[model samples]
Target: MEIMHAVDFRTQLTSIMETLAKTAVVEIGKLFEENSSFLKLEITRCTRENESLQQKCRLLESELQAARKTAGKINRTEASLSHGSTGCICVDICTPTRLDTGNCKLYITNTLHACFPDTAHRPAIDNVFGKDWCLNLWRHEESNAAPNEDTNLSSSGVTVEPVNLLEEEPDMIMIKEEAFEKCSSDKTEEDQNKRLRGAIQKQVKEILPELDLKKLQNVVNHLVYVVGVEKIDDLTFVEVTDLKDFLEPIQCRKLVKTLKQKDFFQESNEQDETPTEITLTPLSSIESIPEQPFFPYCPANSEWLQRFQIPWDRMPPALTQATATGQRARPGARREFVRIVVAAMQAICPNPNLAACREVARWIVSTYPLTFGDITEEGEQLGNGYSCLQRQLKTRVEHVNRDIMEHRIRRPRKGLATKRGADEESYVGKKFRNCKADSYGCVNWQPSSIPEGETPNSLEMKRKVAAEIFQSAGPRAVELTNVDDLMQQTYVYQRHMINSCPPPSISEIELSWPFLFTERGLCRHFKTLTGIDIKSRFGETLNAKAKRILNYFNSQRLRWNEEIQSLLSEIDSDSDGTDNNKTAISAILLMMKYFKEKETSIFISADATSTKMSIEKEMTLPATPRLIMLGNSLLTSSKWFISIEGRVSHSIDSQLDFAAALAVFFGCFYVFNIEYEESAIATLELIQRFFVRINTEGTKCTSKSGTSRKTGSAVQRKSQNFHPRVATFMQRLSEFEWKTSN
Candidate 1:
């Protein structure tokens, strides 16, 4: 009975399975039919939508044709009215000064013009605009003023009869209204651009002072595309295609890149990029510029003039102008031209000696076709106002040759020193300044009991100070703690660095535990001192592991000179063409970065020809930014300039010469035909001499030459074939002092 029941159950299950399979097949078939119908409907909808778009496009085309016709008519009217005048004209509306309200009024003038061929005028009927901003078809209709009438802007506005749109034909008025609206918008854009240019230029001078004007030549296409695509309203700059324009593009990019890096701007979103109202923020407030000279006070122009000797007078005729269509500085205008150029330089510099004159002249001459345009024919060489200007510049530059050849006239300088070699005597040994006690975290700086006026400003009483500092470290020295709290304290400590940072006081707790800080600067400080990265994990938790490694070097308490040298040598070895060298190189760079950022003040000798000047400066403050030039030849061949008789801060604290370091670092990396060790040896030799000079002379070895027998210093040493001119140039750089003022 059990076997029979089992067989029956099996049969029943099989039948049920078969029945369910059949039912599912029918249901799936129905679903397929429904899905096909839905797809058909979607196709129909899309087809209809596409047709509608096509129709709209056709309608817009017809409207565009009509607008173009209207524009053609207005163009004819304008052409007839302005038949005898230049294509462009300006009619300024001056504000009354008699009332003497100091506030300057906006919309001081109204200009009427048509520009940009592709963009037609659009109606702004709903958006009423002022006439001053309107873009109307302006013409001296049937019988008004003659073409030559003087329409100088005055306190009284231009006299004109206003035409009412209501009285004119609808079609004609519509076209005029569109034109007027466009003109208004363009005028506003122009004004915004003017202000933007001023702001941008100011930023360039501040951030990228070493940038040469030539770098700006290739930025037009990139800038225009960015502005047009992004519709960047704040910088709605127009592109100029003139062959004579010398715009500053590299400097512009430098400013923008820096601002972005500093978080002043965020990267533009690729998605959801719609044109929105732009808000431009002014750059961060920089330190006030104290009255100072234009050039570093090296006071050795005879060497400078000879070394930086340029061929200013060899005004090579434009190579493109292959046909020697002789163009000379016009005979009668030559004297006047020279006079104007000299006068302009003298007025601008307050002392147009040959050296000063040369510096300004090189910049002027770089203006290319703008300053010296092509002269195609005989009359082209005639002294027009533009030609006169060019001639004047050339004449001033020519003075360099005369001075160098004759050496008869003494180079005139400010405070003309009656005694010879006064520059050397006046500036020598006078630049030792006391480092402020509160300023901590200085490279190799130890706590000193003596003041600025006292000897031993820089002492290596490290073991004693280390005990005090480590004792204060207390809990921080024991173990890892809250990183956030430590970072805040470190931020406050950095602010105590008076010259580079703000004058902020660090509390006792913060001062006691500075090494516990895990900020960018503290990380750099630890890495520079010891080869270990204390804050590898960017956030809190100052690497407890890395801290152990710092014990070795920190315990020894090496002398300041010994420490700096050991660190540099280690960096040099690690940074030599290896994948793992980035950290080491970065450590070296951080040590010099702050000093490079500080303002460097220079006093240009009143006499351009003679190098006689003094630089009064504080070692903590800088005059100009020093750029690390790793151009096409960072590792192979880099140049070091040599000039004599210049000044640098007499403070020993300013010993890390950024320029010399670059020469050493890149000189090692540079791929020369010589053996790697040979290249490194030469670079190391240069660095050694730099250190020797720094120790003997208070100056960074800039003013006194290694060869200057005037002091108890070693003879100027040379590695291989270091150029004499380059040596001289480097010598002159050591004598400048820093501003002791706020």
Candidate 2:
């Protein structure tokens, strides 16, 4: 009975499934039919629309043909009139009418006294435009030609009164208004352009009187496009094309080159209302400039001139042309000029004082205003116009002096004993002498003694105690403990250790002074030594200048090396904490490039693929400060370690913000009493003197050589010193700041 009941249930289920499948098939078929019908309707509608568009296009083509025929006939009639007495009269004597075909026609018949063909077509024109139209047209042309006369005569000898077109045909006035406005605007624009050209020419002539007038005028023609343009690249394509049309390609190139010059567009302080009267100084006056003989201060030019076998009285033709005609010399020529001038100064004295340089510069400018004069836009001269010349002279003098000092060449005066060398004044040494910890100058560089009641022996004991606490720590509560006082007491002893001739290795120092490696301990130590809040100052400055610094790097993207370019690309692609690390690393790398230093000099990275044995070998190397990035992708890692004394001394303590890491890296130079790395001295010095503003001077960074001679003391070694590139960078950075501020 159970088997019979099961069979019946299975049969019922089979019948139900077949019925549902049939119903679904019907529904799907209905849906497919509806979709097909909708698609067919859309296709039919589109076909109809396409057919309508084709018909419209054909109609437009036919109307265009008709308009062309009408235009051709009108042009022929106008050409006949132009060859006759009405040639000079530019008048629109046709009334425009729109035809059913959507083309506009000039209906000459609607215009009274409109021009027509000669007497052969006179009857036809009279029938079309009414009688005497040709006669009236001739009279109209004669009247317009002689506007001062009240009447005009036709071929038939009838006197005709001049008619005012606007009064007689008010409707024509509307049609002519647009043409009148267009003509007047073109005339005004032409006049404006002329005035702009004249103004630019006058300014250029006043400021640079020695410029060739023909070339100056050509440049001036293009200056009209730059009336309100700030940058040369900002000129529009049309404006640039127009400029090219006015001058040859080479002349246009020269114009752009001149505009890019730093001194070319200096703002003038002179009042526009009171234009200064310029007096032309004759060549005779310049030729008569009294020669200022060099004495104890500066060397005489005769010695070097004789050495080079150059005629003393006669200057090089290149120099003469540059000075006399104000022609810009080639780079090679200018460099040769500097070399010759430097040789002259170095003959009697390898190092000339500032006064001597200024005196020489003044003589040059005074003798040749056309070449050396630094004139403002208002034609006012800057103090002697010789500061740039003075700077170049000083730089060349120093470069020669460095070579002299490096080779230990002596230039002894006849009557005087050998003077101590001024080369001993290292910018770093100077800062160390009057060292302050912050912008508020204070003399805390050398702490004479430890805190009261704390003897040197007791501080040593406390340092050991702190070390024990650090070593045994499981997240040591540094802030909650009294380790701060212990750290403070041991600071004097720590300085002594750091300043030791052969500074202790990272392990030795850490073992003795473990607290110094911690964030709090490092901050306190740097503050006590230099009076700067490293963490706070680093964060503040980085936040303020990060975008600008990145922008500066971005601007030089094409100029960087592959490694640096790769790093910059990564920075642009990522904006996480890793980006800051890459930014800081790239900045250091770029600075190294600017100073022509090697990357391995200050930085060594460990790749993910790098063998443990290789890193272990790097760890066993000599004691020197270095930024260490662990892992591949070149400093993209979150952890940046400072390796001083062949070991990782401290990890960057910014929770991945590398600005603080950078600050500490710089502070290591001061803290360790380590002279800048020999290979990266200038790069490091610029960071110290300019960005850090530790031991800054009013003078520019002028040193050209990269070698640093060790003085008597290791800590007192001279830096690689100046880089003109750094000076230029500073200048541009300041300008960038000024632009951003405004």
Candidate 3:
């Protein structure tokens, strides 16, 4: 029994072993297959990477060859120039006669100018190159007959007609000579200051020979404005830190050393002129210095007072009645009175300083002691009694000044120069003198009146019909000229509806006017309201500035956020090619950070895995318009969406790129006639000024017909005017461009 049991156990063990062997073999086969698949994938990935590297190498090789050819050409041109060939280098290389384009023209022009900087040699150049040679070179045209047909070359090989490039002006040489003659003829304090500034500039240039003349001028201007230092005697007040923004550490050190030497020379000269002995007068015999008024007081019978009286008489009966109530007026009534007073004040002084505003406020208080006075109920003085009025008057004047500085409207002095004797006129200055400002500032934003031909009921009927058409036939159907006409005719009513208090939700607005949400519809509506071709303006500006925009991008060396850094990397990778979309987006981002604004205000990126959550979170915030990037990353974004009024109303294809997306996104603000996101106002304003070139006084504007409505108080306007940052950005860019050109 034991033997038989043992034999059975052996058989059972053999069977079990066979089963285990079969399982092991199957597992080994599966492992081999998995390893083979992984190896295949790895090999495929390596091959792709190798191909990509090879392509990059090929591109680099081609670029190197082109660079070599350019270097060779430049060398030949330089050789010819050094040898005094006297050939029309500009005509040969820059004229339309040549198939090549780019810095060749700039190079020859610069070389010629460098060789002949004096006016004496300018005639020689003219003799050699012809009377219209400079003009031809600048215009890049074969003939000077078509002087108006000037062109600027861009990196993408596209040509753009610059606005002021072709405008006929006095010859620069003549202008300089006239200026020099004027300075020489006048020995006034102003002329002396000019000479002093010129001397300082010359010294600075000597100290920093590598720096551009423009950059040195900027540095001098910085000193003049910031430190109130223009005279050689003022050199003691300047510190190296004052120039930190404009120069490198080493440059700043060198500049400081030079300034110290200048100061030493100035001291030595003063010492040589100082008298050895001094005399003192008795205190009782000395006459007291007159105490100057803290605020200059204009006489009641002065020109400004007379000017104010005329506008004061033109006040509407209702406003006059309201102010005569003698009690503190309501906000609206007070605003009207303040407007009249401020308008009258500005009429006399188009750009009033704080002291001027104080005088106007004092006059107003003296005239209307009961209604506009800043007094306590107990009749105690309220610190000058005109403080409140002064604040208002100062604020109003500041708003207008801010607008001018921001380039929203042309300078009153600039526009006023055109009108004779009216230089003293009391009219609202040209509010939209700049083409871009005019286009953007004319939007029927905050329209208070309906169209002349349309009544409220008619507008409502048109809206209903348009909504029905949009719902049934869709956005394409509404794009028809007929539908567009209806939309245009009711734009005023639409503005009223969108701006209604306790505003409608995004879904409600979309449902009621779906066409307004379409891309074409948005642009058409914006154009109808603002008279601005948003797409064309944005595109033309972007394309014209494509090379500069890329230069601006590559110049950013500041430590940035991860996202911005990633964008900068992409831009660097695509350095050989120009990508307007990428450059524009990066520029906007960099500018936002430069201005110390939150990036999420104008742009939001969502991970593809959690787009819903990311966007949902965004919606919960305020209804600020935003550009949404919906994908795992910005570069690989699957879609772009414009999120306005807490909803993604428009989706743009990824391939359309961010420029188009931004254009549409920007249009949405005007089409809806909505305010920019509060936090992102600075960033949006930067884009408006830098990209769209629309520097309107205010976004919440009035109708186009009447005198342009004034912007808000100084505080409000200051918040809205991001021109300080924009100006700094532009100044830096200008300096960079000057460097590149030189």
What lDDT does each candidate get? 0.32, 0.53, 0.58
Candidate 2 to truth, TM:
0.41
Residue range 1-742, candidate 2, lDDT tens digits: 9999999999999999999999899989966654453355357546645644565566667768977986786566445544645432333422111122111113333332344434533212222122254346545554555653333223334434443332344333223345569768766655544444455566555544423444455445334322333222222222334455433232333344443344444432132332222222222111111213422223463233223322223456777666544433334454577678767766655666655765666566545544554432222233225555676777777776775664345355653332324444344355343322221111244455568887777887887788777777722445645788777767778877765645566677777787777666777787887656777776655544545666776876887678667767766676564455566656666667555667777777676444435565655544767766666655465556677766666665436566766676767766655555556666765565444544322222222344432332234333211334554565455445545656
Model 3 lDDT, residue 188, Cα: 52
Q: What is the lDDT of candidate 1?
A: 0.32
**What is the per-residue lDDT of model 3 for residues 610-688, given as tens digits with 9 covering 90 to 100?**
4544676655544767888766555455467787767677866445666678888987766665656555665676566
User: Which candidate comes out best when scored by lDDT?
Assistant: 3
What is the descending lDDT order? 3, 2, 1
lDDT of 2 at 547: 55
2 or 3, greater by lDDT: 3
- Which is superior by TM-score, 2 or 3? 2
* Model 3 score (lDDT): 0.58
What lDDT is reached at residue 616 by model 2? Answer: 58
- Candidate 2, residue 497: lDDT: 75
**Residue range 1-742, candidate 1, lDDT tens digits:** 9999999999999999989998799889955654453355357546644644565566667768988997897776555444544332323323212212122111211122232122233222332233332223232231233442444223256544444332343344345556778778766665554344334443334444432343231222223222332234333233332211223232233344343332222233232233234333211111111222123222364334333323345333442132133223332333444555554443433333544543434343333322243222111111111322333353555653455534334456666665647866888878564432221112222211233333322222322343364466642442344433333333323232422222222233234333422123244443332222433322122122113222222333353345444553454464443322233233223222211211111111121122112222212222221122222222221222111112221111123332333322222111110111221222222232232111110112121223322354456443322222223222222211111111
Candidate 3's TM-score: 0.38
Model 2 local distance difference test score = 0.53
Worst lDDT 10-window in candidate 1: 692-701
